[model samples]
Target: MKEKLSRKLAQNVEALKDIFQDSSDLVYRDIQFTESRRGLIVYVEGIINVDLVDQNIISPLIEGLVKAEKPVERLSELPFTRISLTQTSTASDWPGVIEAILTAHVVIFMDDSDEVLTFDVKGGSRRSVQEPSTETVIRGPREGFTESLRINTALLRFKLKTEKLKMKPLIVGKITKTDVVVSYIDGLAKQDLVDSVLDRLKQIDMDGILESGYVEEWIEDNPYSPFPQMQYSERPDTIAAQLLEGKVAIFVDGTPFVLVAPVTLWQLLQSSEDYYERYFVTNFIRWIRLFFLLVALMLPGLYIAVTTYHQDMLPSSLILSIATAREAIPFPAIIEALIMEVSFEALQEAGIRLPKTIGQAVSILGALVIGQAAVQAGIVSAPIVIVVSMTGIASFTLPRFNLATTVRMLRFLIMILAALFGLFGIVVGTVWILVHLTQLKSFGVPYLLGVSPYRLRDFKDIFVRVPMWKMSQRPNSSSETNRNRIGAPKLRGRADEHEGW
Candidate 1:
């Protein structure tokens, strides 16, 4: 019934009703263009800009047709220039017409004509752009991506106002038909990489894409791996930076978070603030983050192994202190650590799921109370409580939550290994994780691009924040042919003085 539009206005309205059954938001307004000529306007109520339709579409047509001496069957015969609409198109089929309506376009059907004119008046209540909660920076633009797809693209365009910036739109999902835009700089990003991303996205067969994570799972290089292959950001500056660095960004409709692909593990540890701050400060912070990252992953297991089997490796004084603390505890070192770790993890989960007003208070108070009470009850040792608390704190230093979660999960695995074989098990598990890291690929790009592949140029921005002038070339990991980001430093200051001398 919705395959084609009928010439009769009543029949077309009935077909629309059949398709949109029980949806009260679908509005139908019958209009008398002239005493003789008639038509109908159909649009979703809330999403449509009612003022634009009334002022531009309805007023122009009604007044123009009334003043005209002759009656016309087609609306194209009347002058449309009098209206203020900038975008107007004719859709002949029901699919195109219905899609346009769903995307906030007004559809006008004439009494005798088979075609419907769609006006793009996409205005509705939407969240205003606010500073991103995840990627906050002290020295950069505070604006972030909104839920509106067009607004997100416009934000990107405002950052990178180059003709080389390209946005290719694609529709996915059968039932919802969500809008997705693939954005990248034209010549900077590798053609093969772009094609691979497009191919993977086109193959997505899903009922609906509720968020960017949905698309990430389907199109990522490794779906089974616990590590996140694609990085997601709600900040426009972050997305713009990735695009300029020869990466592709997928912008999904109705989601503020956008996905950037071919991300490396080093990139996961980085924050937007790293680039915004001075090189020395950022370098110090980077090293600190790396230190905590290791602690977050191995602290608990190392503590367990040391206390249980590697006691001789510790100093006599420290061993005695730990022994004194665990004198009353009956559980083994592994069990003690597991109890505190599990309790801490539970508190963290509750904090996130609970309301914001009490979540932080609950997590902090719960950890303090549980740790103090457990120590008094002799159910767990004090040293184990300290280790678990340190591990949780270390995990918070990771900039990306997904990477933090990966660390959290792997911590338990390593803990199990430590429980069985002590220090030897910890070494074996760390090596296995390193091997997995080396093997992990994000869209065919090495996950450890600068570190494993040993590219010196890429390392300038990876492990340490080199001075902006020193980083003359973009990351070789991006596979850019024209990698020169800044030309050779000109003879401007000291060099100019030397030349004058």
Candidate 2:
């Protein structure tokens, strides 16, 4: 329980001093409203707007009281218009007052009154909007989410202007007391999914929620699963698009990455640029990415398996070339593949860890110089180097970093299985992965949505990027009630006729 503000000024001052004893940033000032009426103002030094507090709060109260023919009985009862700031509210207890002050609001205390007035002067330094570093696109909105939570929400609001869009505020951490916002279209989002997400968040009683990833780990359907059940993006257009499809977006203060839940594998693979560009171009790109996705996951393991246990599968010319390359090398196919894969992964990590200029140089040279040296020294075969380099390049095409990382990890695991049982091992591992995916759920939606327990309608935007004219319904993974996103006919108009607005 918190102590209530006293009717006496000196007592309240002593209590405030005890509470903010060692805090040097707390600013407390006493002002005389009239010859008889006294008051105090409290705020933090850097956070609160000093000029606004002075002009709207202090100057008006002192000047208005002096100009009045009769003195006011209490500060709260003051009849002057500019005496206190607009959007001002009263706090009767110390906790409320302190909370207001901590959140960058200015608090005014009257000597004879038991209530304190809090003015919303939350002006401090913050980052301006800039282009996203992670999720880049050529033809969509260039603006991205900043570290500021309010700015991020403002970016979303700028894209979507509708009363149906609702943001429910939540406080997650006990010590950090970080602000979290759950945003979704009120009618489109399923009530049960929203309720489950809120309940999971409320149950998180921890010291801190430093990043949105923290909440993500806790609320995700399967913590141990390598697959990313929830998708995170720094683009407002992405988040806005998800909200329109009835997905809930979770925004954590101090992190630019926002978490979008009830995500499917198809959603993870798709990019915002797909919707922004021409349909044919996007479709072609999607096919290319899909092909590379397979190469990233299966290329290394398949090479090892076929060369080791099923060499007859390859053509005679290719076999002769692979045999000639391995003639000088001592290591088997599995060991050769493992050596190249590990070296490539190390170079990738080094590139990310080093400084920007040097990192790029190192990642490029590290692969070229190291691979060439290894091949010439006969420590590894040339074919293995080519396979590993192609696998690395293919992994880069994945849109989401988390998904790409998952592919890298699973690639190694499948490689090991292939080393043990050859072609059978690859089949076994693939079956196990498929079984796990079929069993997995993100929130309540299936992980392999549109493919497993398949929804045919949801495939409009999946592997093949269908034209927007044909995509009239929202994704089924959202469990949306009103699914008709576009109301007109599938075809826009005839080739020769231009439809008039």
TM-score for each candidate, following the candidate numbering: 0.96, 0.93
lDDT of each: 0.90, 0.88
Which candidate leads the pack in TM-score? 1
Candidate 2 positional error at 221, Å: 1.1
Q: Residues 201-228, candidate 2: write the lDDT tens digits.
A: 9989899999999999999999999999
* Clashing residue pairs for model 1: none
In candidate 2, the residue pairs with backbone N, CA or C atoms under 3 Å apart (3 or more residues apart, or in different chains) clash, namely none
* Poorest lDDT segment (10 consecutive residues) of candidate 1: 489-498
Candidate number of the best lDDT: 1
